[model samples]
Target chain A: MPVIEVTNLHKRYGDVVAVDDVSFTVEAGEIFGILGPNGAGKTTTVECVAGLRSPDRGRVSVLGLDPRRDATQLRERVGVQLQESQLPDQLRVGEALELYASFYRDPADPGELIDKLGLGEKRKTPYKKLSGGQKQRLSIALALVGNPEIAILDELTTGLDPQARRDTWALIEQVRDSGVTIVLVTHFMEEAERLCDRLAVIDRGRVVALDSPAGLVSSVAPEQRIRFRPSAPVDDRLFTDLPEVTSVQRTGGQVVVTGTGDVLHAVTSVLARNQIIAADLRLEQSTLDDAFVELTGHRPAE
Target chain B: MHAFGQILKIETRLYLRDFAAPLLTVALPLALLAVFGLIPATREPDPQFGGRSFLEYFAPSLLVITLAMSAVNILPTVLATYRERGVLRRLATTPASPAALLAAQLVIALGTILVSAVLLIAVGRLAFGVPLPRHPLGFALALVLGTAALLALGLLVAAVARTTKAAQGMAVPVFMVAMFFGGVYVPRFLLPDFLVRIGDYTPPGVQALLDAWTADAPQPLHLAIMAVIAVLAGAAAAKLFRWE
Candidate 1:
């Protein structure tokens, strides 16, 4: 059985439909990404599933329990890390962990979970004293203390530095490896690409695309791009004559070549025959970001 | 039962960390108690009330003040801060119930109020030679009614205040009215007849009813009415409380 199944969820605030007919399933032990820009209903959908909000329309089942009707049971099985949620300023790391753990019937040992999150040395530190990245790690640790079957993380690495972001990604992977189903809400295409098995790209309260990162990118734009700065200006038509090269465009000293199969080999041979030692040469594949912009016609903001 | 205990512990820890507020909670009232209970009573007893010292007349009132401070002044701040900081929202996702949180707050407040009451009573006895209550049952009845009334009033304040700042702002004016008119600052009998009449209609009006309940000569009818008002206010608070 699916660990979480959300069907036709709808929520509106005033005239704004925060979540409009969002439907998805998260399989057990898989990392499911809810990819969307801000105000795209990612957080609302997750909050409804986590029993924080009661949706006006739709059915949500987490571990076969209704999020609203079986709120207590659902909270016990699901762990949630909200985007702007906070602990009290005076609450210490260890105290916060223990207090939350006490709310569960069978909680993970607070000391062990703290150690796992590398917060052992910061146990006595008040929440106000921690850095942003440290606070994020502590929030994740609190979410896991219930020994939950599913974990929902919203904007998991939004404020972290690059190195901290990578460390968080590793921790997420470790959590997934332990057989915990993860529902990651993220706007970062790279995060979705690196971490998710499947993703749903939502826009304006509607899902625009749903597939694996590779599948979505391929489905949107399947061709590969090759670019090189030639020693001398070359005619665009000359590159297009190659068997693998589908199209070519030249502007200034650079040539952009689009190709079908074996494009790299064909382009490199063409370059060699012309005695053109490419100044800046690269082959590129379509990324999730490209698919997102193509689908929504807007670059996602942080 | 275990969950209840855990909630109580968490609430207590949070309260302990707010060192300044609680010290004021305990100290301010005790200072008032010492001033009113000892300073005026040094000379002699009031012959009209059967040779009772002023300290004896006011020690029970200090207990009511302690209860008022805990429920009316302190409880609103605690609830308002939790709501403002999104603590209630966070707890909503946990196994803790709304009812459980309120219950924990009541238990913690009652416990602290009781300790403060004991200290004030001891100080009154040692410093001013105030007599112990002649009727323990009557004093207990008045104490219970006063506590219920203040808890109700505090919860009511929490329901109306949207933010912690608003709650703190509301607490001051409301507390002054409840204290001055409720007969904690000065006994109602000493006020002008019109003001006394108004005080009787307010929470401190109910205090006179409690005072009547625990008076040297007990008054059962007054105690029953005061106790009924306490229950109604508590029910209203519960009905109106918003966990958001």
Candidate 2:
């Protein structure tokens, strides 16, 4: 069974719609990414799924329990790490994990989780005294301390340096390996591309696209661009006549072939038939950024 | 609930870790008593003070000022900071409700004030030759009512303030007004008649505490005023409290 199901979720605050018709399902043990730019209702959608906010219209199920009706039962099984949440300035690292651990019926060992998160030395340190990376790690530790079956982390790496972000990503994969369904809400295309098994690209409170990172990229722009400097002259019709080749163009002593599946193989074989070597060959594949811009009609501002 | 107790234990420890609020809340009032209590003039009974020692006149008011400091300055600011920092919202994501944290804060604030009151009374009798309240029940009743009224006002401030800095700023006028009219800053016996009249109408004002400590019974009128303030402010606070 899917660990979480959100169907036709709609939520609004006064006149402003925070989420509209947002729907997705998180399977067991998958790192399901909710990819979107800021203010795209990513947090609102997950809030409803976590039972922190009730949807105005929707059906949400987590582990076969209704998020709104079975809220207590749901909370017991779902862990959440919210964006920009803070601890008391004087609360120590171990004390925070212990406090959160006490909230669940059966919780993970606080000491073990803290050590796993690499915070053993800072167990007695106050929250305000920790660096940004340490605080972020502590927040993630609190989420998993409940030993919840599903964990939802929102904006997990928004402000971290590149190295810390990569470290957090590795930790998340380890959590998933231990049997927790992960719902990661993030706007960083690289984070989504690196960690997500399947992504629901939310744009302006709606799901614009849903697929794996590579699948979403290809769905938008499947054609690949192969560039090479040919050893001899070749006719454009030599490659265009093939089914996979869409167009062949020449640019500044180089030939650029644009086509769909197997385009590279078809062009290489044609060059070989003409006894020509394709030098300085390079293939440019479309990234998630390209797909995001194509689907959303603009770049997600970094 | 177990979660409430856990949060309370951690919160109490955290509150003590701070150098300013808790220290000043309990220590400042006791410091005043120690300084004034050591003086012989305040210890001697005199007719100008209605046959009561000058120390007795200020003892109950000292406890009232402690309540004002904690409820107005400390308690509301802590709660507002929790909401400002997203602690309350974060708690909502867990099996524990955020209301657990709010309840724990109230318990800690009241507990601190109660301890302060007890220490002030104990130290005064032991070191300064001051008598404890003659009517224990009346003193307890007035203390409860006064604390409730002040806390309700504090909760109202926390409910409406957007940030911790704003909470402290908004609580200042309430704190100052309580100090001035509650007879903590000036004795009711020494205040002008018009100002005394205003003090009589103030909620958690020290006059009831004074009446209970020195008189046979606390006046029904003072108790009724505090009860009214508690209800009105408490209702407003409950209606306006926000987690974010």
Candidate 3:
């Protein structure tokens, strides 16, 4: 059975519908990503799953128990790192972890999580004294300290630098590898494409598309654009007449061919036949960003 | 209960690190006592005080200041800061409820209040030669009721204020009202007859506490008013408090 199943969940706040008709299931041991830009109801949907908010119009089941009715039990099994939530300014990193650890029946050692999240040197540092990246890492450590079955991390890398972001991504993968299911909420297309095994793209309180990153990319765009600089002059029709080629154009010194299905091979063959070497050859396909724009009809904020 | 203990332990540690609470709870009241106690005239019994020394008569104001500062100013700011900073929101996500965190904070505040109370009484006895409350039982009862009433007022401020600055701003009127009626602003003797009557209705029941401090018993009217205010304000605070 799926570890989490959300069906037709709807919630509104004083006539403002924060979440409406959001539905998805997270399988055990997989990293499920909820990808959307800010104000897309991504956090609200996960907050419902985490038992922080009650849904107005549908059923949500986690571990075969209702999220609201079994909220206490659910909290024990579902560790949540909320978006824009924080600890006391004077609380030390190790003390914060240990305090959270004591709340659960079974818990991961604070020392282990500190080391795992690279917060060892900062164990004695007060929360307010830590850098943004260090604070983010400590919050992640607090979430995992409870030895929960599922961990929901929202906007987990919003404040980290490039290297720290990469390091955090690696740490999340390691957490997933250790037999825990993960629900990651993020807006960055690259992070979603890299970390998520499957994702549900939320936009304006609805799911635009739900599939693997590659699947979403392929479903929206099946063609590839191959760009190369030819060693010798060539006619555009030489490539355009092929079955796989849709259009051929030359920009300055470079020839660009757009086609679907084995178009790269077909273009290379045409180049060889003309005794022209394709210099600086490159092929690019539609990424998640393109898929997002195609599905939502607007570019996602970077 | 176990989770509450752990959270309480951590909150205490954080309280020490910040130390604002301890300073206000222990040092501020003692400093007030020292400044006033140094006056030779304050130690002399005067006709204005009905044959009571200033140090003896002004003793209840020390308690009033300590309680009002904790319940109205210090505690509200701390709680409001927690809400503003999302500490309560994060706690709500864990197995331990946010109620546990609030309870822990209250417990820490109560600990400081208790320590301050003990020290105040000890210093009054040893240094200034003021006797303990004439009716110890009445004094203890007033202390409990006064604390509950003042803390209820503080919680209401904590519930309503959105930021620490707002909490401080909001607390001013409340703390001032408490101080005014508690006779910190104007001593009960100097106040008009009608105003002294109004003090009986206000929370912290400072007149009742003073009566219990030097007389046989606190007024029953003051205890009843404190109980009613505690329940009503506490209910309102519970209704209005926001986790985030």
Candidate 4:
């Protein structure tokens, strides 16, 4: 059974509909991602699941418990790292971790958790004194201190540097390895593609597509590109004539062929038959970034 | 109960770490008392104060100042800042509810005010030789009711203010007005009859009730007004406060 199931969720603030008929199920111990641009209802959907907000219409169940009615119970089982939530400026890192840990019946050791998050050196440092990345890590540490069955992290690495983002991704993988289901909300395609087991791409308050990262990329743009430096000058038309090939282009010493369905085999067969050897041949697959643009009609905003 | 205790513990620690707030809430009132007590005229029994010395008559108002300054100027700003910074929103996702944080804030504020009151009373009796409240039960009742009324008003301000800066802006004018009415600059006994009557109706009006209790003449009317303000303002604050 899925750990979290959100069906036909609808939420509105005043006249503005924040989420509309959104539905997805997160399997046990899997990293489920909600991918979207800013204001695309990713946060709203998770807020409902976290029991932070009640849906106007729809049903949400986490661990077989209704999120709204069983919020108190759900909170004990689910950890949450809100997008922009902050701690008091004067609060120390160890103090914050200890305080949050005290809320749970069975909590992870805050000292070990902080050390794992690379915040051991900053234990006594006040919140206001920490760097942005440190603060983000502390937020994640607090979320994990409860030893929750599931963790919901919104905009997990939005402001981190590339190195810190990679570190966080590794930490998330470690968290999942420990048997905790994760629901990650992010607009970064690379983050979703690398970390998420499956993704629900949302746009304008609706799920446009739900699939694994490779599945999404292939579903949107099935055609693959094959590039190589031809041993001898070759006619680009020779590649396009093949049934599997769609278009062919020649740039400098490289021959580029774009096609679907066994294009690599068909192109190589043609090159072999033509008495020409293809050197440094490489096939490039479409990325989630490409799929996101195709599905949403715009690039994910930063 | 466990979560509430944790929140209270952390909140108290953070509150104490904040030098400016404690300085204003605790030390400022004592400083003012000491400054006024040094004047020989303030130590003499005065006909204007019904034969009580100025130091003794002003002692209750000084205590009220500590409570009012904290509730009006400090409490609202801190709570509003928490909301603005999403601390309350963060707590809403935990088993420890945001209401725990609000309750913790109230407890901490009242706790600090109680400490300040004790210190002020000790200093008044020791350094200034002002008499303690003769009707201790009435004095305690008036102090509790007065704190509730003023803190309720502060919560109302916190509910309406969108940001910490806005809270501070809203709190300052209210603080000045409350201090003026509570006889911070001018003693209530020395105020014109019309001003005194108006002052009697304000949240700080409890100062008059405290004074009456200190003099062993407890006034039911003053206590009733304070209780009414406390209930109404408390209800309104609860209704209006938002987690985010």
Candidate 5:
């Protein structure tokens, strides 16, 4: 059964339509990714599911409970880490965790959660004094404190340094492994490709495409590119007859060969036959980012 | 409710953490009480004014001012900041009703104002030999009315302020007018006859009525007027208060 389902959802702010006729289902125990550029209504859709904002026209269900009708029940089961959330400046980390814990019937131990998030040393520090990464980890800790069945993490690693981003990614995988269904909203293609079981790419408040990262990439551009620098310059005529070789281009002492299946075998055989010893051999597969741009006809605007 | 208790704990925790702000609110009034109370009864005597010493003149006004500082000057900024920072909205996601949050705030405001008033009166009696209130019931009634009135006005400001900064910007002008006219920094009767005549129609006038009841010569009519102002201000505040 799906943990979350939204059908024909619509939300408008004055004349601006934030979410328009969007629909998606997040299956239980799957890492579902909602990928969109900034202002693409990703947050709005999630907010409606979290019961933070009321939709004008739509139906949303989480854990078989209506988000608006059973808001309290829904909130108890789902954890959310909002974009740029803030706690009181004077509130210490430990105190904030304890306070949030009191809102739920069964919550993870504040100390244990803080320790897991690597916040034990900064437990006494006020929210305002914590660094950006520290704050993000603290927020994740708070979201997980309820021991929720489903977790929504928005803009998961927007400001984190590379090391912190990797740590966060690990933490997310750990959370998912615990059998909690995760709905991740992010603009980072690498994050979506790395973590998402399936991604629904959105544009202009609408879902443009939805599929697994690999499936989407394969659907858009299945061919691969092979590139190498020859130890000695090879004649272009030597590789012209291979059936799998779709196109070949060379510039600045580097040769790029593009083709479909078995291109590697075909190119290597042709090179060997011509006695063209190559250096710096490399093969590039189509990335999710390429598929995104291919399908949308533009880069996902961050 | 449990949520009310939580918000109360949160608000009180903040107040306790900021010792300087709350301390200044309480101490400034108490210091004035002592200074005015120590003056000799015969010094700068005024035939028309009822009090023989400054302490007798300022003690009740000090209570009104204390109420104004907490409810009017301090609360709007804090509540507005909470609204702007998403604190209130975040809490709203919990089972905690907006009523619970408001109740917690009012409880803390009353508690602080009561403590400040008690300290000021204690200093008035022990340090300056100011006589105890001749009419205890009247003093209590006036205190309740004044606190309610000020708190209601503060809520109105919070409801109207779009941002925390706007709330801060508003506090300066409202506080100055309330202090200057409400008989805290300046005695009402000392004003020119034209000003004194109109001041009674405002919060200062209502406070003066309550203070009159504090004197050996009590004025029930003045207490009645203060009660009316408190009710009106409270109604206005309740109508305008908003969470977002």
Candidate 6:
């Protein structure tokens, strides 16, 4: 059974529609991602699943229970790390973990979770004193303290440094491996591509595309590019005549081939036939970043 | 209920760590009492107080001032800061309701004010020879009712103010007005008859109940007015309070 199901959900703030006819299901033990640009209704959708906000129209269920009617029971099973929610500034890391632990019927040992999240050394540090990465890790630790069946993390690594972002991603994989279904809401394409099993690309309060990261990328632009510096000067017609090649360009003594279906194999064989060695060859596949721009008509920030 | 206890424990610890709130809510009241008690003329019985010394006449009002300052000036700011900082929003996602945190804050504030009241009464009896409340039951009822009414008003301020700075700004004028009616700056008996009558209906007017109890002539009318304010303000606060 799916761990969470949101069907035709609609939410609005005054005249502003934050989410419109949004629907998605997160299966058990999968790191399902809600990927979108800022203010794209990603957070609003998750808030409904977390029972933090009731939908204006349509239905939401978690673990087969209605999010609104069974919110108290749902809370016991679903862990949530809200996008901008925070603990008290003076609250120590260990104290925060302990306090949240007390809210659950059977909570995981906070010390163990702290160590797992790499926050053991900062256990006694107050929240305000912790660095951004440490604070994010601590929030993750608190979210996991209840030993929930499903965890909803919103904007999990929004402001973290590159190293911290990668570290958090690895931690998220470990959490998923422990049999917890995770719903990650993020705008970072790299994060969605790396961690999510399947993604729902939300744009302007609607789900524009829903598929695996590679699937989404391939759906928008399946053509791949192969760039290389040929050992000897090569004519563009030699590559253009190939069946798999769509376009060929020569820029400052380097040859670039854009094509689909065995293009790599076709290009290499053609280069070999021409008796020219292709040096510095690299295949650049389309990424979710490109797919996102194609679907949303702009980049995340734009 | 268990959540309430845990929240209260943490909130109390956090409250004590802050130096300013404790100084204003707990220490300042006692310090003021001491400073007023040291005056020779205040130690002598005065005609204005019907043979009671100034220190004796002022003890109950000082307790009211302590509770009023905490409820009006301190509680609203603390709750509003929690909302501003997203603490309440965070708790709303948990099995423990954010209402538990608000309840714990009220418990802690009332507990702190009660402790201050006890200390004031102890000092009044020991150092200044002010008699204890002749009607202890009446004094206790007055204290509880007055605290509830003032805290209700604080909750309304917290509900209306979007930020801690705004809460503090809104609270100051209310605090000054409460002090004026509770006779912190001027004796109640010295006030003109109509003004004194008007003060009798304000939330801090419970000071009249406390004074009557201390003088062994408990007035049912003052207690009735306090109970009415407590219910009305409490209802309004409950209707207005927001988690975010």
Model no. 2, DockQ: 0.86
What is the lDDT, from 0 to 100, of the residue A291 in candidate 5?
Answer: 86
Model 5 spans with C-alpha error above 4 angstroms: A221-223, A231-245, A260-262, A272-275, A295-297, B41-48, B97-99, B204-209, B216-242
Among these predicted structures, which one has the highest lDDT? 2
For residues A197-226, write the lDDT of model 1, one tens digit per residue: 999898888888889889999888677898
Model 4 chain A weakest lDDT span, ten residues long: A247-256
Better model by lDDT: candidate 2 vs candidate 3: 2
- In candidate 5 chain A, what residue range of length 10 has the lowest lDDT sum? A231-240
Worst 10 residues of 5 chain B by lDDT: B204-213
TM-score of 6: 0.95
- With a 3 Å backbone cut-off (N, CA, C), the pairs that clash in candidate 3 are none
Can you write out model 4's per-residue Cα lDDT over B16-131, one digit (the tens) per residue? 89887788888988998899989989988888777889887777777768877889888899899899898999888888888898899888889878988788888888998877
Per-residue CA lDDT of model 4 for A130-196, tens digit only, reads: 9888999999998899999999999999889999899899999999999999999999999999999
TM-score of chain A of 3: 0.97
Candidate 6 stretches greater than 4 Å from native = B186-195, B206-210
Q: For model 2 chain B, give the 10-residue run with minimal summed lDDT.
A: B199-208
Ranking by lDDT: 2, 4, 3, 6, 1, 5
TM-score of each: 0.89, 0.96, 0.97, 0.96, 0.91, 0.95
What TM-score does structure 4 among the candidates reach? 0.96
> How big is the positional error of residue B120 in model 5, measured in Å on the Cα after superposition?
1.9
Which residue pairs collide in model 5, if any? none
Instruction: Please report, in order, the local distance difference test score of every candidate based on alpha carbons.
Output: 0.80, 0.90, 0.88, 0.89, 0.79, 0.87
RMSD of each: 3.2, 1.7, 1.6, 1.8, 2.8, 1.9
